[model samples]
Target: MPQPSQDDLKEISRDYNRLWQFPNCIGAIDGKHCEIICPAHSGSTYYTYKNYFSVILQGAADANKIFIAIEVGGRGKQSDGGTFHYSVLNKLMESGRFNIPPPDMIPGTTCSLPYVFIGDEAYPMKTNLMRPFPERSLNDERRYFNERLSRARKCKCN
Candidate 1:
């Protein structure tokens, strides 16, 4: 087995960060579970959405929805927000570990564009991350946000 060098990690992060564009330019965040034999120490904490005692796997994807980095082995009961907090996502922001590019150069944009993650209901809302508003009908705010992302869209493989 071999380990990637620091440069390799930086390049990977940079690519994922630039994946698409603002609102559209976020990495995808999702969680899965890995089955494991019940551990005497934390069996109860390992129960998850699937009713299994397993370790959770968290991942970040590019605009293409291709996985860029992954973290696994946390207890399953952990919420997506909790999992992200303990994973590289946290360290990246705190230590400036991710290789995000400088702000976009498009004309007439006052907002400082941000690279973020697209999360689900299990995650928390914040500036660096976004989630679909859990409403029966998409209202004006959600509509505007969603419209911006889709308008700036990239292909699934892009």
Candidate 2:
């Protein structure tokens, strides 16, 4: 799929805020392993922790669960973070060409925050990406934040 333009990102952020109450969130990103037959001459490259031959499908979706971008065919043995690190989406983000919007003030707040994509613990925390606080140490505020973040990141499967 084509990269989202700045306008597209803005619209997505609006949807997320309206539907999920997550402000300045442009999308939700995650990876899934799809089972597949072992390829001839391929070694353990496709073998996953789940004990299956598969490929990783990493994707970012809008609040309405529409895919905005995708990267597939990553080795199943790779972690979600590892697959994302080598994805075109990551490259675009790293190069600052993904057209992400600039930082803006939060609604009813003077603090400025950058638009970000919500992901699970599998993904790294970056200026444009958000992950929940570590489970090992959690206060009431952090727990509530994790709950909200998880709600926003949830993608219903068909």
Model 2 alpha-carbon drift over 4 Å, by segment: 155-158
Evaluate model 1: give its TM-score.
0.67
- Which candidate has the top score in lDDT? 2
Clashing pairs in 2: none
Cα lDDT listed for each candidate: 0.63, 0.91
lDDT of 2 by residue, 2-52 (tens): 889999999999888888888999999999999999999899999999999
Residue pairs whose backbone atoms clash in candidate 1: 21-25
What's the lDDT for residue 33 in model 1?
A: 84
Candidate RMSDs in order = 4.9, 2.0
